[model samples]
Structures are given as C-alpha cells and as structure tokens.
Target: MTQSEFVNLVMPFKDKLYRLAKRLLVSTEEAEDATQEVLMKLWDKKKGIGSYRNVEAFAMTMTKNFCLDRLKSKQSGNLKLVHSNYADDRTSLQKEVELNDSLEWVGRIMEGLPEQQKLVLQLRDVEQYDYDEISEMLDMKPTAVRVALSRARKAVREQLIKKHSYGIQ
Candidate 1:
C-alpha cells in the first residue's frame, strides 16, 4: 500500500484499536504506546499488509500479543512494575473512575476466559467484528464462532456471579 492509501485506510481505525488495547492493558499510557507501536508497525510494513486478508484483525492481534507479554512479565516477577503501570493518573482527569473500574473488571473477566473464548470475545465485542469476520480472522467456522461466544458469555456471567457472592474482595 502507498503511504497515502495506508494513512487513509487506517486513520479511522485508531479509536477502535486504542480502545481494544486499553481493554487489554487497563492503562491509558500503555494503551496509547501500544496503539502507536501497532500503527508504526503497520506503516513500517505497509508493503506486506496488502498480503493479509484483513489488516485490522492483524493489528488487533499485534496489540493483544503486546499486552499479553506485559501481563505475563508482570505476573512472573514484577509486582512493583505492574503496580506502577497504573500509578500515574492525574487527579483532574476527565474520565470517570467508575468507567475505568468497569473496564478493569471486564478486562479481568476477559483475561480469565479460555484462549479461544478471549480472542473471539475481543474480536466480536471489543473490536465489533461480526461472526463471519471473527470466523475469518480466527479461521473458525461462523457456527463455531457463535457457539464459542455463547459459551464464553455464560462463563463470564457465572464468574461474575461467584465474584459477587464472595463480595469480590
């Protein structure tokens, strides 16, 4: 893809991509960095992007892999590092805390999902990809995509119920 074509094709996807990264990272700064990194990657490989069946899905996969790496390292041996990832919020930030809290909960719920469920849910819910798009991206049949999403939704509901019962401390 040419520079102009790539820019025009991808500029509109920024917000959606950023939101998906934020859902994965739970930190605005990290999400912003990931978004820039993903965009930079696409720009750097503009020639190769045309070979992919779906560039947006490819970008989302990149963002997810980046966040998953961070999460893994944080869980491995970086207590302070992970805590610090979310420590720099400004007092006067415009976003309501409640919204962030909700996203965080949903993010955790998503993290707990099985690998297939999580990817399917992120594609379908977070990225607004329909079943066919999701199936195409994940190389699953549309019926399988629907079944996985249904089961994943039920699992999330059950986990939420149990968390509530335990007071979610």
Candidate 2:
C-alpha cells in the first residue's frame, strides 16, 4: 500500500483502537502510548500492509499483544484515568446528561461481560462490524459470533432494564 492508502485505511480506526487499548490496559497514559506505538508500526508497514481484509484484525491483535507485554513487565494493578470525548448530537442539555449517565451504566454492563463476549459485542455493535467480519477477525465460526452477540445484547438490555427499574423507585 502507498502512504495515502495506509493513512486512509487506519485513520478511521484511531479512536476505536485507543478505546480498546484504554479498556484492556486500564490506563489512559499507557493506552495513548500503546496507540501511538501501534500507529507507528502501521506507518512503517504502509507499503506492506497488503490486503484490507485483515488490517483491522491484525491491528487489534497487535494492540492486545502490546498491552499484555507491557502489563506483564509492570506491576499490573488498576491503571490511571484518562480524559475522553463523547458523542454530541442531543439537542437538550438535560437529555445529553442523562444519555451520558446511561452510557456509563451501559459501559459498566459491558465490562461485566466475559472478555470474549464483551469484545464480540463491541466489535459488532459499537464498531458496526458484521458477523462475518467479526468471525474473520477473531477466528471464530460465524454461528458462534451470532450466539455471542445474542447473549451480549440480551445481557446489555437486561442490565439496562434492571438499572432503569431501580432508578424509578
């Protein structure tokens, strides 16, 4: 791939990669450094990135390996907090605030999922990757992806419903 092609391929994935890194390593600073290192590696491989089919898959694998390597070398407790951005489409400030709260709850629910399910759900829902794409990326059967997504969606919905009911009291 050419320089421009490589940039186009990876530009859209920056935030997703950062989020994944942050969550996995549980540190803002470390996540940023990991993302930077990941991007730099990609930059070096632009000419040899080859097919786009495996680009995201390969990138995610790299992120996981990098985080695990760093974590293994370090003390490995909870990581420090990092600042983040949010979606901004709501018209009302109150609604936006409420949405933020709801998102936090949802994120908590996601964190509670088994690691495999959580990653599957994030790729399928948040990243809008289809089952085939997820299967290819994770080396899972397509049917397994479907089952995991079904369970994940049900879990998220159930958790949200329960949280809402608790709130109404």
Candidate 3:
C-alpha cells in the first residue's frame, strides 16, 4: 500500500490503538511511544497490509502485544494502570462524590485482577469490543473470552461487596 492508503486505513483506529496502550501502560508518554512503534511496524509491513482481512483488528492485536511486552519489561517497574473514565457533571455533589469513590474502587479492583482478566475486561467493557473481536485480539476462543469476562466481572463485584460489607468475606 502507498503512504496515503496506509494513512487512510490506519487513521480511523489510531486513537483506539492509543487508548488500548494507555489502558495497559497507564502512562501517556509510554502509550504514545507504543502507538508510534505499532504504526512504524505496520508501515514497515505495508506491502502485505492488504492481505489482512481486518486491518484494524490486526493493528489492535499488534498494539495489545506491544503494550503487554512493555508491561513485562523491567522498564515498566514504576508504571501502574489507573483509569478514570467515569464522569457525570449534572449530578448532585453528593452523587458525584459517591460516583468518584466508586470509580476509584473500580480502578483499584481492576488493577488487582490477573492480566488475562484485566485485558478481557478492558477490551469488552471499556472498549466495547464484541466477544469475537476480543477473542481474536487476545488469541482466545470465543467461549473462553466470555468465561474470562464473566469471571473478571464476578471478581470485581465480589471485591466491591467485601469492601462495602466491612471486611466480611
């Protein structure tokens, strides 16, 4: 593919790619570097880009792998995932505070999850990717993706309940 064609194909999903990286790396600078690296890799293989049936999915997979590798590297020692995607300005002050607290708990809970569960939750709940797409991106069977998402959600719910229940397990 030519430069312009490559740009056109990738521009549509570039932000999603960056968001995924950011979700995993939890640092804007690292996410930017990861996004750039993924783009460079795609560009390097532009000659075969047309062979991919879903270029976006392929790109997403690349982003996911690249970010995971970074997370596993020694350089990521100081990094930690912290997401704050909830917002509701129109609510009462008390409601807003409660919402913030709930979101904080959610983020902490997510951080404690296993990597597979966390990635499955992030892709399915945050990114709104369907089971098939998540399975394809994560290289899991569709049923396995569903099971992981279910278990992740259940784990989060159980943790929240335990916290709210005053140390009861």
The prediction achieving the highest TM-score against the true structure is: 3
Q: What is candidate 1's lDDT per residue for 36-100, written digit by digit as tens?
A: 99899889988888798888777766777776777677677655565554434322234323335
The count of residue-pair clashes in candidate 3 stands at 0
Estimate, for each residue in 80-153, the C-alpha lDDT of model 2 and write its tens digit.
21212122232344653465477666775676676667778778888888778778766789999899889989
What C-alpha lDDT, on a 0 to 100 scale, does residue 39 get in candidate 1?
93
After TM-score superposition, what is the CA distance of residue 6 in candidate 2 from its true location, in Å? 3.5
Name the lDDT of candidate 2: 0.73
RMSD (Cα, Å) of model 2: 6.9
Ranking of candidates on TM-score, top first:
3, 2, 1
Q: Tell me the whole-model lDDT of each prediction, alpha carbons only.
A: 0.73, 0.73, 0.81
Model 3 local distance difference test score: 0.81
**TM, every model:** 0.65, 0.69, 0.78
- Steric clash pairs (candidate 1): none
Model 1 off-target regions past 4 Å? 77-116, 139-144, 159-169
Worst window of 10 by summed lDDT in candidate 2 = 79-88
